[model samples]
Target: MLQTDDLTRYCDDHRQEALEELEAWLRIPSISADGAYRADVRRAAEHAAARMLALGMQRADVLESKGHPVIYGEWLGAPGKPTALVYGHYDVQPVDPLDLWASPPFEPQVRDGHLFARGAVDDKGQVVMHWEAFAAHLRTRKSLPLNLKYVIEGEEEIGSPNFDDFVARHRDLLACDVVIISDTPVFSEDVPSLTIAVRGLVNWEVHVDGPMLGDQHSGLFGGAIDNPINALAHIVAKLKDEHGRITVPGFYDDVRELEPAERAEIAALPFDETAEAKRLGVPQLHGERGYTPLERMWWRPTLDCNGIWGGYQGEGSKTIIPA
Candidate 1:
């Protein structure tokens, strides 16, 4: 049996090596949304499976999916211990507007005690922390506090298209006493928090096609037809009220209201509106009335257009109305 001091030393010795391996793994461009990077995404998944096996997972494999592959691993040595399912994503967001990045998105860099990379905080870093914890336990001959299973999907950034189905199909394989996800932020830097509830999401794209069959002369057809761009703007403007409440019918019908004590608890959190505003580099904050910024971010539901474009987007002026 390994002693606690031996395990501590092992973790200290291997921490830097583990971080370097993480950086190498992050270098793979696993953008699942882009068809061109499909192979890279699979490569990343396979790499993750291998790493899990090396970390003492009894069964580790890339579970094929219609989209990207899912890396599954489990260490079930502790027979009587409770099982915990840990979920994370290996896929990353597409780095469009590449010029915005100070460094290449896939090139992990450490500066001032923080790692800057595409998947650093979003998921990879968080997932690696748990792996490190497991490695420490193993090195010390200390079994984990619970049976652990890792489900790292490769399409979370793309709405996790296959996740629900995979989970349903593998109910027995994924059975666990508790599910732990590290995708959320803590309440404060000093106070760690465990999230018990997650807000569900619904996404829709409103594509407005222009009336013109093709680009037409603006001088001739500009006033004759209702511009789709203008119509889209008007439609979006009608989605919210002056008080920032969504105008969609029945939008708030099922929304739950916080009790007086809950409201008080939320208000009691340490926050500075002015400091937050300064941090965001905004003159002031705006949101639904009667709620604090924390409440608005965590508890409130919101509606806003993620992207809108209808006119000529290229450089220089074009007098043609695009269809």
Candidate 2:
């Protein structure tokens, strides 16, 4: 058996090579949101599976889904060790407004100690880190502390539409003692954190239609009929209160309160309210009046109007009430 020191040294020596491999992976334009890059996304999934197979995953393959594919790999040689399922996503967000990027989105670049690429921090970097860890263990004959199974999906940036179904269908295959994920960032450069919980989300789009007519003269019909735009604005305004608490019916009945110690620990965390406000380019911070910003973000449930539109938004103002 190889010693731990030998494994550590091996990891150190091959750090550059691992990083280069990550750069190559990042160079693939696997934007799942765009239909044009569907092939690129599949290529990325295959590339990831190939890398895992090379790193000693006995069984590694790309599983097809209704959308993009999911790459699965496992090394279960150790009989007594617990199993851990590692989850990550290879798909990336669409690089719209491409001009905003310093370099092309698919061209990896290192600048000022940071890797600049579309999927660098979003997931590819973190997923590659696991591969590096596995390689280090295998090269030095240092058996993994626990058996690991990798599942890399290609539709996370698009809200992981097919993941829940896949998980349900393959529950037996994916059974593990725990799930390991490295997608979230550390609390700070010096503070590493393990997220204990993730907030659930409910997304919706609202559409309001005015009268049957197309565009009516505001002067002639504005006072006689209800304006859909005005109604939508009113509905949005009623969603919150002066205390920043959501006003949705039954929204808070199920909300659990934080323990006193938990609140104290959160308060003690390194934070500057003024700095946070500045970072957000806001004059003041607002959220559930009693909780800190971090608390509101992580623990409290929120209702936000992601987008709203009903009437004309072109150049100058038109004198017509949209219908």
Candidate 3:
């Protein structure tokens, strides 16, 4: 049996080594969204597989896919024990608007004890934690209590475009008693939160067309012709009311209400709206009127416009009605 105390001590003693490993992995800009970073993405996968193999995991390899490859590793020594599939991703979202960053996204930096990198939290860091935990167990106790399998994919940032098919093809290999996903947010820095469920999402690319055949002089056609940008603004503005409820007909008809037990559990969590607002650098918080902040975040549905543009977006504004 693995002694929890010993494992914790081993991890604490080798914290610097763990940080170094994570920093090395973070240096690779494995962005799945852009085709230009394909080689870098593969490099990241190879790096993960190498770590898994070094840590005594069996069959550690970068398995190919139509898109970015998936890294697989397993330690199935404990017979008749529950198999836990540890899922995470090596690929990170594109670092656009790079000018806003204090340091380079790929160059991992430790600032005030916090690691700053592209994949620091939103998954690579968590992936490293799993590997390091396994390392600690193997180094100290020589074996794990239960079977373990790793499925670190490289296309997760791209909405996991290739994950479903990869799983379908390798059903037996990926089978497990329970899957553990570390790619989630904790409630806060001090609180360790386990999120059982997440809200679903739907995306649509809405386009608005103007009456003009092409761009026209806004000064001349401002009042005569309707501007697509103006029309789009109106449409987006009407998506939600002042109370933060969606204006769409029958939008909340299928939404499930929180049970009494669930509400109680949520209420038990420590939260301060004022502190959170201050931490977020906002004067106040806003959400659906009826639900608390936690309830609104965890259960309620929300609609947001991610990107919108219909006019000139350069240094100087072009005085034209976009078509």
Candidate 4:
């Protein structure tokens, strides 16, 4: 086994270079969710492939998927050892509400010893961590202890629509004994935690159309009909009850009940409810009534409206009904 001090020192030696390269990669606004940023997303994929090639990977390429590209790299120098695949995403979420940001979303900043950037935590940072680790290993020992393969994608921010098909087609290329993921965080900085489950995602886009032939005056049609925005609001509200239980039938049908030991383990976790609320800037805590905050966060299923769009959004209120 490698000494922890030796590994720590090796990482420290390359930390600055790692930060610089990560900041350069982060500068590309790879917002896969927005069609306008398609070129930027492609650039991010190219960057990942290039980084892998620089790290002395045997084969590295940005293969075309039905949607954005998939970056694949491999280093199989170690024989008679287990092979591992590392999966990550180079694409980042759209940085909206620009006004609220203290620094430009794509520009990297170092303040208070933390790297400030759009994809810093949610994943460019994690990808860079993997990059630096492998780079250091290669530089120090000139070879890895075990064979490694990488399959980083560029359409993760959006629902990875074509990734399943792409993976199925390349099953032989992606075959591995195990896969490592770096997107989610451990429980806390000091606490060593491994995520065991991934919640399934179901996205719905609801468009409520009312009698707004362009911009109708609210004054004339106010009481005559139900506004689309109002109707949507009601529909969204009915999805969940006052006690935070989902009103949709069969929503919890497939959820496996936590065992008594599992519940006990969760209950014993060190968590401060008030500190969590304050960290989120919420006045108080609220969620599914029966479960504790930690349980609700990690174990319970939930329904949430991610984005909602309705009428006039401008500097001041426009009195016209929006479509």
On lDDT, the candidate that comes out on top is 3
> Which lDDT value does model 3 have at 138?
86
User: What would the per-residue lDDT of candidate 2 be over residues 1-323, giving only the tens digit for each residue?
Assistant: 74579878898898788888999899999998999999999999988888888877889999988889999999887889999999999999999888899998888988998899999998999999888888888778757778889889999988899999888878888999999998886777887678888777778888877878687888889889888898899999999998999988899999999999888878878988899899989998898898889899878999999779877898988877777
Q: What is the lDDT of candidate 2?
A: 0.88
Q: Sort by lDDT, best first: what order?
A: 3, 2, 4, 1
**Model 3: residues with Cα > 4 Å off, grouped in runs:** none
Model 1, residue 29: what's the lDDT? 91
Per-residue lDDT over 1-323 for candidate 1, one digit per residue giving the tens place of the 0 to 100 score: 74578767887889889999799889999998899999999999988888888887788989987789998999998999999999999999999899998889999998898788889887888888888788788757757778999999999998998888888888899899988899888887897677767777778888777754777878899998777788889999999888888889999898898888877877878889998899999998888888878788778899988789877988998887667
Worst 10 residues of 3 by lDDT: 1-10
Per-model TM-score on C-alpha atoms: 0.95, 0.90, 0.95, 0.95
What is the TM-score of candidate 4?
A: 0.95
Ranking of all candidate structures by their TM-score, best first:
4, 1, 3, 2
lDDT of 4 by residue, 1-323 (tens): 74667668888887787788899999999999999999999999898789888878888899999999999999999998899999999899988899999999999999999989989887888877887788788877798888999999998888889899999999999999999998886878888888887776789899999774676789887877778898999999999999998999998998888888999988887889899899999988888888888888888899999989888987888876666
lDDT of model 2 at position 238:
91
Error of 1 at 161 (Å): 1.3
Candidate 4 runs further than 4 Å off: 212-215, 321-323
